[model samples]
Target: MSAAPKHDVFQAVADPTRRQLLSLLAESDELTVSALSAPFAMSRTAVSKHLRVLSEAGLVRERKAGRETRYRLEAEPLQELRRWLDYYERFWTNRLSVLRQLVESDDADEDVLEPRGPRAVD
Candidate 1:
């Protein structure tokens, strides 16, 4: 049997904290858990947990630096997320295009002129 998936990118970014962690890592080439958690009220361990999710999703890579572990954004996994979004982006774009056409059609103007029912004399 195929090995169970360790993590999925969609699941990893579902958490707000993890999203913020990814944003933080994006701002810098690499950061330690302490530095990454400094902007938040959570402890380093809490931040580490979030980082672990991102790491498993392949969104970030970590390396041991002296006594500290440094984490950097992997980014490639995010491209998968982007690809998924692009599919919906096209879906919405097509939907909106159809709606726009319907609204702009001459038939819409005729509908506006027709009264739904008897209107009180103005």
Candidate 2:
């Protein structure tokens, strides 16, 4: 059987350029390729390539306006990423809480076992 296409939200956002593109799109309703390329040192073509990756990941939507092709952020796909990260966030929070309790208990035990009086000379 043929393998399914491998494009995914994680892979799409993995590149710094693509992440910047997403950030730019998020800040505005839509932006043209030229507008998106303004703040970057890369060429417009490079910016478009990043946009294409976002498009494949369903993290961006494109629309034609007159002579310009405008791109907009599509945030629905990010819900999956957020949910996945939130699960790990809770997991780490629980682990840290347990660790804190253990450390506090150990400190209390150490205090109880420590000698309070000065030692006598032999």
Candidate 3:
């Protein structure tokens, strides 16, 4: 099976603002839109738009909190990315194991070789 997905989680997270929002949400359980946008030098509307895309991707949830709406991180969708990556992780592990074996074999060969003067190369 192909390892990584052709899906667009990377695209969704491409924006610096969106990444910041995700980081903030990860640090806190839930926050109001105002709270989420507090660190950014942007308008409420702009932040809301980013939040909307995140919501559509199942990465965030918005719910009415008294008069203000709060955004909560829905991290379960990250599992899709992880599952897609699992195959590649296994492949890399196998490749690294082979590299380690090769390196160890090289060391063993070096130990068995008698000391010799450097060879001249053209």
Best by TM-score: 1
Worst 10 residues of 1 by lDDT: 106-115
**TM-score of candidate 1 to 2 decimals:** 0.84
Report the C-alpha lDDT of model 2 over 3-118, residue by residue, as the tens digit.
54256898987899899899999999999999999999999998888898899888999999999999999999999889989999999999999868866784567755567899
lDDT of 1 by residue, 1-122 (tens): 96644788999999999999899998999999889989999988889988888888888899999999999999988889999999999999999998788778876777664659987988
lDDT of 3 at 77: 81
Candidate 1 residue 53 C-alpha distance from true site, Å: 0.6
Which scores greater on TM-score, model 2 or model 3? 2
lDDT of 3 by residue, 1-122 (tens): 84543335666577889878989999998998899889989999999999887777778888997899999998888787788789899999999998688667845676445558887789
Off by over 4 Å in 2: 1-6, 106-122
Which portions of model 1 show Cα errors greater than 4 Å? 1-5, 109-122
Pairs clashing in candidate 2?
none
